[model samples]
Target: MDVFEALYTTRAMRRVKEDPIPDNIIKSMIDSAIRAPSGSNRQNWKFLVVTDKNIREKLSNIYRETWDYYINSFLNSAKDPGASSLKKQNDKDIETIRRISNSASWLAENYHKVPLLVLALSRNDPTGSSIYPAIWNLMLAARGHGIGTCLTTVMSFETEKVFEVLNIPNDKGWTLNATITAGYPLGKWGVAERKPVDDVTYLNTWGNKTNWNLEQPLWNY
Candidate 1:
């Protein structure tokens, strides 16, 4: 797929079909991932491609525990007295949040059923900027191969348990950064509406807006 096509269509796809991904495809995705640039060429990233059923179950338990808390918190906040808004708008926001939370909860409950689980790690004293770009590349690479992926971090919060389950060394300078679940998508990737470039980009100063008619053919009207 073209770079622009991948960028535009790589949504957070949580629902996937019950299908097994080929090992070669997984290897291709990871190969693309490691080619991403790292801070000072340190390449301080480690990946655990988890296919073991027992470990996936353990991770699923941790994920669901946190997902429930998150959903409940959002529901509680939406019920607060201070959350006044245009009724329709407020209702839409609440419903959207609820739907997303439901999807996350479902994924947590059935994590072990997914074709692949990837645990990404970074150095404890990371440069703080390089990891995300590399992960983004991984997501794009997966998208190109018709695989859906959800980048989640709930498992990272229970770092010690993850280390124990994965047998990661304590002195390896590693810290769990994220977990990504991948499988064949159940539906087409949807387009995410984004703010116009003019609304976000500034000319030379922070607040100065620039006007231009320049347009890219890839995103042509």
Candidate 2:
């Protein structure tokens, strides 16, 4: 697959088919992932590719607990308890938020059935400048092979339970950064819509506009 196509179409696919991804494809994804750059050439990262049904079920329970807590906390802290950060947003933005929330909730409920869960862990990196690039590489590689992935961190809220279930040694200083859920997507892949680059980019200076007028995505395929 073209790199540009992968870049444009690799959106967070939370809902996916239960079909199993081949072991070779998963290996290729991680092989591509480790090729990504790390700080000071110290690749202190571990990718735990989890496929066991029992382990996934345990993690799913913890994930659902964290997800519900997060949502409830956000609702309680917001000015309008029912609005959920949607009080002042326009109709389009509101719809987008709602769609994302629904997808996330669905994933929380069905995490064990997603076929694969990759836990990205790193050590001795205060900022996640090392492991995240590798994770992105893995996701892009999966996209190339028609596998969809969604990177999530809600499990981080209860890392102790996660580490216990996965048998990750807590004394090793490994920080659980993110969990990527992977499977064949149930929906069609398409370019993810986002704000125009020109709208977000500045020319050397902070307030100077680039005036590039990039109103649409550069890669549409």
Candidate 3:
């Protein structure tokens, strides 16, 4: 797959088939991930690729619980039925969020069914600058192989439970940065919609506009 194609279409594919990803492919995903730059070149990252059904079941339960709590908290905090956040969002933004939330709900309900789960951990990187690029690289690599992936952090809410389930050393400095679900996609891949680059980008000054007027994704899959 083309690199630009991977970057453009690699949205969070939460809904995926249950077929197992090949071990070689999984290995390549990590190999590509480690090639990503790390903060201060420390390279202090570990990926725990899980394929055991029993372990996935345990992690799924924890994920479901946390996901439920997260949704409930968000809903309960909405003081007004029309407004979901402290700063009111426009209709388009709300709809986009609604779509994402629905996809997330599907993943939470079927977390155990996803073929693989990769837990990315890093030690001593407080800002997460060291690990996130590797995570993105892993996802992009999955896209290259026609595999779907969703990077989620909801499991971080139950850090100790996850560590116990995975037998991760608690005394060690390892922090659970993200949990990425991987499998063959059940849906078609397409370019993700976003605000135009011209709207977001600025020139040398903070408020000075670039006027590039890039209204669509540069690449189409």
Q: Which residue pairs come into collision in candidate 1?
A: none
What CA root-mean-square deviation does each model show from the true structure? Answer: 4.1, 2.7, 2.1
Clashing pairs in 2: none
Ranking by TM-score: 3, 2, 1
Top-TM-score structure, candidate number: 3
Off by over 4 Å in 3: 80-92
Model 3 whole-model lDDT (C-alpha atoms): 0.91
Candidate 1 residue spans exceeding 4 A from truth: 74-96, 210-221
lDDT of 2 by residue, 46-146 (tens): 99999999998999999999998986665444435456555445557656766788989999999989999999999999997799899999999999999
Model 2, CA-based lDDT = 0.90
Superpose all Cα atoms of candidate 2 onto the true structure and report the RMSD in Å to 1 decimal: 2.7
Instruction: Show the lowest summed lDDT stretch of 10 residues, model 2.
Output: 75-84
Per-residue lDDT over 96-175 for candidate 3, one digit per residue giving the tens place of the 0 to 100 score: 76778899999999999999999999999889779999999999999999999999998998999999999999998999
